[model samples]
Target chain A: MEQKKLITYTAGHASVRKQLLLFWTFFIIGSFTIGGGYAMILMMKRYLVEQYHWLKDEEFYDMLAISQVTPGPIAVNMATFVGYTQGGVLGSVLATLGVSIPAVAVIIVIAVFFPGFKDNVWIQRFFAGVIVGVVAQIATIVLDMGKRQKWTTISVIVCAGSLGVLFFVQQVSPIWLILGGGLVGLAVEALKPKSAGGASS
Target chain B: MSFLALFGVFFKIGIFTFGGGQAMIPLLQKDLVVNLAWVSMKEFLDFVAISEITPGPVAINMATFVGYKLRGLTGALVTSLGVILPSFIIILIVATVAHTFRTNLWVSAFLDGLQPVVLALLTYAVYSIAMGGIPAWWGYVAALGILLLILKYGKRLNLFLVLLAAGGLGLLMFR
Candidate 1:
């Protein structure tokens, strides 16, 4: 029965051991991550793509994109998405719990014991530096993700134009850019001939 | 505040917050500080500061911090659960739907379009962080150095250790 169950769920890529690994992976990410949700992206890429090879680059990027559009913290959204991909509902629960426990536990400790620690200059300095490191790591990941995309004329225009608006305007919500990108994609799909002319640049 | 109220407020916050940690700040200040008056302005500021410096998602940190301040450990638990619940439910539904229709042509095309835009957004994050976070020449050097280190070492290097080393570097230089 146990062997049969493993075969059944392996079709979805969930095993008890892999589920446990998912929990443990997210637990560690939840514990050490600083800065914010974006920082967690690099960590997730490292674990899921580079280390465990659980997700391919394309699929990982897909989840990253989805996590952005969905409401809430990107890290938690990602944990839920990746967990579900691996283990269905049960995987999602365990992974979400894994990522969330550290924040809850750590904050409770800080609140109950060391509310004044935020004022500590040394700790501030330390985190100031950690921010630098986080930025660097994220920069590297962005470069890598950029390199992987099959950039064409339209793709480059959309990417660059959106990046410019996001960086400079500061008022435009990202949702518009995302929706616009989808529209452009659909437009391209609609225009393409139903033959081998799909390679239009 | 009652635990249920605390949970409900956080759940509401969760449903509204898009983007992530930084985006949630204004909403939190508005809801908790301005509207509800659950925390004083100064306390709210302190919570933001603490959340910034601490490990984990800013949303989780802020929810936990505010919740604990209001009602202690149980409050923290409730609030964190509340904040997470919306995203959990939404992602589950979205993921399930996407999984079911992944092979459909339209969905794939939409995702393909999203890919470049997402890449652009990720690039913008790096640019913004560089502008806001890096103050000096050495900071750039440090960033570049770390990038090379990661590229060379790949998964063999531990990111946490890199962070610790950067912290030490900050102390040595900035202090």
Candidate 2:
């Protein structure tokens, strides 16, 4: 009989012969995740649009949009889902580390010696600029998501209505805001004609 | 709690926290502040403010600040490391094996669906921040202006200037 495909690992096919492989894999994954949160964001953007071609700019925006609203960093959450989907928990950890290693090394070094770097006003100024760049990047993601999802009158209504209820009115909580959106999504999808079900936009 | 216990607890938080630092705010508030009574509401608010104002992961800042407030500098370091340790350890584990895992199709679809929702939440967050942080009509106008400039020029625009400019404008108009 053929061997059964056991769910041996949450990520990667961690074989019995190569336990060392798993440890090294884990270490590298963890290190990278701690390091490269931002790089992962950019990389994910590229992967969706260019490599897999699974996500157009809008779908990429959708990925980014949901990633932002949920828990953890965008990199960790999205990467985890991707990794876990691939390899399980092990895969999740790998993607997490791949994204994080650069940041951990840099941040630890910075944290350890930030006192020394503290006096440099120019560095602070540069960081301030980095902040603006980060904001713009995040904003771009939002706009892209809107465009990608092809925010129809209804989606736009949901967006505005959610905004109003969330910020302006304050009757419902964010939990509800999300739930409401999901409901709206189900409704919208239901309303669409069955023939053109490829809501690709 | 023992140092190790504290380390373990924050480690769990670090590993589990999704949707960035802000997403964990309510749970952190409830567990540490409300239920456990590890911190007071005022102290929690102070930590929240500091985390938001400072750069880096908002959760890390809170962990450090709360640890320091509760014990001392050692507490700060321990808590900070604890918060990141799980992620650090796990990422290292995953990195070496990721290339092999990248091709799994089942893992891909779930992530696909989640992405759109996450983005929507963020857009909502931006709105929330604007409502709470902006504090004026001019503030809203400044946000729009900054957004426009960012779209046009991209990262070429300096964020420090943007923030300072926004703050300066806030001071000029509000004060």
Tens-place lDDT digits, model 1, residues B82-161: 99999999998887666433355566567678778887877888778777666677887888898899889978889989
Error of 2 at A37 (Å): 10
Total clashes for model 2:
61
> On residues B102-129, what C-alpha lDDT tens digit does candidate 2 reach at each position?
1332232333333344455556655555
Model 1's alpha-carbon lDDT is 0.82
Q: Residue B85 CA error for candidate 1 (Å)?
A: 0.5
Clashing pairs for predicted structure model 1, backbone only: none
Poorest lDDT segment (10 consecutive residues) of candidate 1 chain A = A1-10
> Which candidate number would show the highest lDDT if scored against the true structure?
1
lDDT of 2 at A110: 45
Q: Candidate 1: misplaced stretches above 4 Å?
A: A1-13, A196-201, B100-102
